[model samples]
Target: MSTDLSSTPPGSPGAPASDKLDRHVLVIAGVVVLGAIMSILDITVVSVALETFQREFDATTAQVAWTMTAYTLALASVIPLTGWASDRFGTKRLYLIAIVLFSAGSALCAAATSLEMLVAFRVVQGLGGGMLVPLGMTILTRAAGPERLGRVMAVMGVPMLLGPIFGPILGGALIDNASWHWIFLINVPIGVATIVYAAIVLPKDDVEPSETFDWLGMVLLSPGLAAFLYGVSTIPETGTILDAEVLVPAIIGLLLIAAFVPWALSRRNAHPLVDLRLFQNFTLTIAVIAMALFAMAFFGASLLFPLYFQQVRGEGALDAGLLLAPQGLGAMLVMPLAGVLTDRIGPGKIVLVGVAVITVGMGMFATLDAETSYYFLTGALFVMGLGMGATMMPIMTAALQTLRGHTVARGSTLLNIVQQVAASIGTAIFSVLLTNGVKNEADPTALALGEIEDESQLRAFLEQTGIPAEQLPTILRDLTDDLAGVFSGTFWIAAAMVAVVLVPAFFLPRKPPAEPVDQTALMGH
Candidate 1:
C-alpha cells in the first residue's frame, strides 16, 4: 500500500545512477540473463530428447515422461519459497547456490544409468532452474529501477523469448550428432561460467530475514500449485479436464490454494509466503491478469506451430524447429524498440498493439492448409513474434514498477507462479482442442482418401502419411486436408485466447511511473 521510495538506496549494490546506463549494470544484466537462459533452454531441450531417453533406459513412455514431469513439479514446489529464501540468504548467495545445484544435477543426469536416477537428478535440476528466472528478474529490476525497467527487461526477455524456439533445434542436433546424454551435459559449461561470473560481479546485499518462515502458507501453496500444474499437464494425455487424472489433483490443489488465502490474509504476525494483498494495487492486479491470459495464449499456441510443421508438412524435428525460427526473429527485432516505447508511453497501448498483431498472425494460421505457401506461413509467424516481443516484457515491467522495494521479490514470485500455471492450462486446453479436432476429422478424411486411384498420387499420399505402400489401400489414408482443417481450427481458438487480453490491456497504466527512484536503492545501499 505504501510507495516509500526514500527508504531504499538508489539502485541495487553496484548499480549506477537512475538516469544513466553503465558498464556495471550491463555486465550484471548479461550474467543474470545468461543464467536465466540456461535454465529456460534446458526445459524445452529435454522435451525433444524424451524418446531418446526412453530407448536408452529401456523404459516405458510413462516412466520416461517422469524425467520432465519431475522437473516441472519440483519447479512448482520450490517457487513459492524463492522470496523468503532470497531475503533470508541474500540474492547473490542464493543465485550462486542455485547454479551449483543445477550444475550438479546436470552432471548426475548425464551420468545416470537408470531412468529413475535420471528423474531424481532432474528434480535437483528443476529446483535450481526454478529459482533462476524470478530471482534473476528481481535482481535486474532492482538494478535498473523503474525508469529503465522496460529496457532492462528487453535484454532479459531475449533468452526467455528465444529459448523455446531454439531448444528443439539444439536438442535435435545433439541427439543426431551425439547422444541423449549431451542434452543434459551441455548445461555444465554454461552453468559453470554463469556461476563464476555472478560470483565475481554480483554484489552481496544485506540479508533482512522475515521474523519467521511462513510454514503454514508454504504447506498450503506449494502443493496447491504443484497439484494444479500436475493436473493440467495430464490433460493432453487424458484428453479432457473432466478426466480423473486431471480432476483429482486439480481439485485438491485449488482447495489448498483457497484455504491458503484466508490463512495468509489473517497472519499479521509474520509475512505470508506470498503477499496476496499485493492484488489490492489496481495496476498490479490488471498486470497480473493480463499476463496470465497472455501466457495461456502464447504457450498454448507455441505447441501448435511445431506440430503443424511436423505433422502437416511432414518435416522432421529439426526441420520443424527451423521453420519456427521466424517467430523468434520477429520478436527479437521488435523488442528493443518496444521496450523504449513502453517506457515512454506505458504498457497499455503497446500491449493492445501487440495483441492486435498476434490476432492477425493467428488468423492467418487458422487458414493454413497443405498447399499454404511457405512465405505466408513464415510471415505470419514473424508478425506474431513482433507482437509477442512488444507484449511480454512490457507487461512484466509494468507489474514490477507498481511494487515497493520490499515487495518486489514477492511480486516477481507471484508473476512467475501465475505464468507457470497459465502455461500449463494453455497447453492443456490447446492440446485437447487439437486432439479432438483431429479425432472428429479422421473418419471423414479416411472416406475421402479411399477414392485415390493413380499410383503416383497414392505413393505421394503414403509418403506424407508415413504409411507403408502395401497398407495404402486397406489401412492408410491421406489426412492432409483433415489435419489442415484441425490445425486451422485450433489456431483460431488460440487467436481468440490472445484477443481476450485486449479487454484487460485497456486497464493498464496510461503512462510511465510519475516519480522513479534510484536503481541502487533496492539493494539497501
Candidate 2:
C-alpha cells in the first residue's frame, strides 16, 4: 500500500498499484463483486430446491441434503490456502481463474442428470466459490488503502447482504417458473464477462511467488472438519444420536482437527494451509470467533425460516422469499451508517452495540406462534439484518485493524475459513436439534388426540413415535412454527456469547498513532 517500490519487486508481490487510473479497478471490482454474489448465493440458494432434488433422485431427505453440506465442506477445505495461493500466483490472475472455475462448476451442475453428479459438481463449485469473499476483502482493502476502506466496505457489503435474500427468492422463482438447473446456469454470463473484464482492466502482475503448498495440513484440516460436519448432518438423517457409523467418523474428524493446531503452530514461515498464529492478534481473534459463532447461529436459522413459511404457514417458495426481502433491505439500509460509525468510533465499540441488537432480534423471534403476525416475524428478521449490517464492517475492520499491509491478506483468508467452518457446524447442529424434536414430538401429538386409531397405528408404528392427542389436529400446521423457535434458541445463545468475546476488545491497539493512509490503494475513491 505504501507506494514505495523499494520493498516489493514488481514480479514478486501481487498486482501493484496501477500506474494510472485504469478502467482495471472497475473491472477487477466488478469481477470480485459478481464472484462474491455467486458464492454467497450458493450457500442458501439450494435450500428451496432440496425437495425437488429429493423427488427427482428418489432420495431420502438425508441423501438430498448432502447437496448443501458438500458445497460447504469443499469451501472449508480450500479457504485457508487462498492467501498463500494468491501471493504465490498473483491476486488478479488467481481471482479471475477462480471465477472461471466457479462458473464451470455451475455449468457442470446445470448439466448433471443424476444426484451423484450434482453433488460432486457442487463440491467443485464450492472449491472455487469459497475464494471470492475473502479474496474480495483482501483486494478491496488493499485497493482502497486505509483512508477509503470504510466507504469501500459499505459499498461492497451491499451484494454480500443481498446474497442470502436473493438465494431463496431466486431459487423459489427458478424452481417455480423454470427449473433447478437455471440456478446454476445463471452464473455463466456473469463469469464469462468477469473473466474478460479482468483480463483487460486488471494490471498484469507477473509475480512468481515461490512457496510450497501445505499438503500435510490440508490432509488433516479439510477431512477433519468435513467428518465433523458430515457426522452432525447425519444425526438428522438417521434421526438418532446412537449411530456408531456416524459417531466414529465425526469423532475422528474432531480429533484430526484438534491435531492441526500443534501442526500449524510449529511451522514458522511455512504456513501449513493456515497460520494458527494469527490468533495472537486480539482484534482479529475476537472478530473471527464472534463472527464464526454469529454465522453459525444465522445460517442455522436461515434453513428453517423457509421451511416454516412453506410447510407451516402454507406459503409458496417465491412468496416466502419475497416476504423475507424486507429484512435484507433493512440491513442494506443500515450498513453504510454502521461503516461510518465504525471508523469514527472504534470497531470494538461499534461491534458490541451490533451484537447486542442482534441478540434482542433473535430473542424476539424466539417467541413465535402458529398465528403470529407477518409484521412480528418480518420485524424480527429486520432487526437481525440490522445487527448483521452493524456488525459486518466493524468486525471486519477489527480483524484488519492490527494487521498492517499484506499481512491483512493472510488474516482475511483465515477469517473467511473460520466463518465457513463455523456456519457448517451451525447448520449441522441446528438441523440435528430440529430433527430430534420433530421426530420425538410428531407421534405423541397424534396419540393424545386419538388420531392414531387403527390404520393410523400403522403409520405410527412405522414412524416409531406418537403425537399428543390434543395437538394432533394442528400438528402439521404448526411444526415449522415450533421448529423456528427451537432454532431461535441457538441465536439467543450466540447473543449471550458476545459478552465473553467483548472482553478481548481491551487489547485492540488504538488506531496506530498518526497513521498515514495508503493512497495508492485508495485510487477508486
Candidate 3:
C-alpha cells in the first residue's frame, strides 16, 4: 500500500510527531521574518518622517500625510487578493513577486521629486507590501506545522510588536544623520537580500488546480475597504467623523461592504474573493473577535505614547522612541515562554491573563501627569509589554491551530485584514477624542498660538507678542499639564477597550485538541 505524503496534514497521526522546530523550519522562519520586518516596520518608519516630507516637499500637513495614508489605503486594497493569488500562483512564487514589487516601489519612492510623485510611488510600495505579512504567516504556519505553531508564531510576533517601538528611532537616526530618502533607500539592500535568500532557502511550491477568480466580490470589497479606511485615516485631520470627506466615503464604503456579505454567502459564487464561510468555525470566530479588540485598544493608544513624550515632556523623536523601548523589552522577555505555555495548555487561560495585565498597564497610563516619573512610566510600559508578549501570538495560534490545509492561507489573510481595519478605526477614534479634549482644556488664546514645535519657537512667539516674562513659567506649566490630562483621559478609554477583549478570550479553546484537526470537517469538503 502506498500513502500520499503530500496529502497528510501536519500533526496528523501519519505526519511527523516531533513538537520541536527543526533546522529546515528554522531557516524558513528566518526568511519569513526578514520579509515581515520590512513590511511591518515600514508602517511606523514613515510615520516619523512626515514632518521631514512636509519640509522637503513644501506641502501642507494633510498633503504630506498622504505619504502614509496612500500606502495604507493601497495596502488594504490589495490584501483580499492575496489568498486567491497564493492558491493560484503558489506561495513561493507569489512571495518572491511581492518582495520584488516592494523593493522596486521603495527605490521609486526614494527617487520621487514631488509630493504627488511620492504619493503615487507609495501606492506601488503598498501594493507590494500588502501581500508580504499574510503570505509570511501562511509559509511559516505550514512549514512549522500545528504542533510547533506557538513557538514559530512567537518568532513572527517579534517584528509586529517591535515595529512601532523601533521605527521612530531608526527613522529619526537616518533622517537626522543621513536624509529622508535613506528611509526608503535602506530597504533596497534588505529587499535584495531577502529576495535571494527566499528564492534559495524557501521550499518549492506544490501547485494545485485553481478556482475561478471572484471579480464581482473584488469590485465590492477592495474599493469598499479602501474608501472606508481613507475616511477613518482622515479623522485626526478632520476632527470629526461627521465631515463630508469622512461621512460620504464611509457611508458608501459601508453600503458596499454590507452588500459583500450576502454576495459572499451566495451559492452562485462558489469562490468568493474573501471567504466569509471561514467565520462559520466557532473557535476561529471567537479568536478573531478577541484579536480585533486587543489590536484596537493597544495599537490605537500606542500612537499616543511618543506624542506624549514629544509634545508634553519636551523630548526629541529619538528620545521618545528610546523611552518607549521598555515596552518592547518587556514583550521580548515573555513571548517565548508564552508560546510554549500556549502549546502545553490552550490559548484561553494565557490570553485572559494577558488582557488583564494589559488593562492594568493601560490603567496606569490613564493616571499619568506631566510630572509622572520616568521610572514609573517605564515600569508601566514593561508590565504592558509582558501582557502583549503573552496575548497576540497566542491569540493567533488559537485562531489558526484548528484550520487545516488551504484554510491556513485564507485564515491568515482574514486575520491580517481585520487587524489592519481595527487598528485604523482605533487610531481615528482615539485621535478625535484627544483633539476634542485638548480644545476644551486650553484657553482660546493658547489655542490660537497653534502648535509650538519647540522651546525656541515658543520663546520667539512670547517675545514677539510682548507677554510678560513673569507669566512664561505659568503658561508653560498649564499647557503641559492640560495636554497630559487629555492623554490620560484617552488612555482611560483604551483601558476599558482592552478589558472588553476578555469576553471573546473566555471562549477560546482551553486545551489542545485530542484528535488531529480534521480538514474536511472545518472546510466542509
Kindly report which residue stretches of model 2 are placed more than 4 angstroms away from their true locations once superposed: 1-28, 206-209, 239-242, 267-269, 439-525
Please write out the lDDT profile of model 3 over residues 116-142, one tens digit for every residue.
999999999999899999999999989
438-458, model 1: which lDDT tens digit per residue? 878867536445547588877
In model 3, which regions exceed 4 Å deviation? Answer: 1-16, 448-466, 514-525
Give candidate 1 regions above 4 Å deviation: 1-20, 267-269, 444-477, 516-525
Model 2, span 229-271: residue lDDT tens: 7776676666665798679878998899898888877734355
By TM-score, is 1 or 2 better? 1
| Candidate-wise lDDT, in order | 0.84, 0.70, 0.88
Question: Which residue pairs in candidate 3 collide?
Answer: none
Better of 1 and 2 by lDDT: 1
TM-score of each: 0.90, 0.83, 0.95
Clashes of 2: 13
Per-candidate clash tally = 9, 13, 0
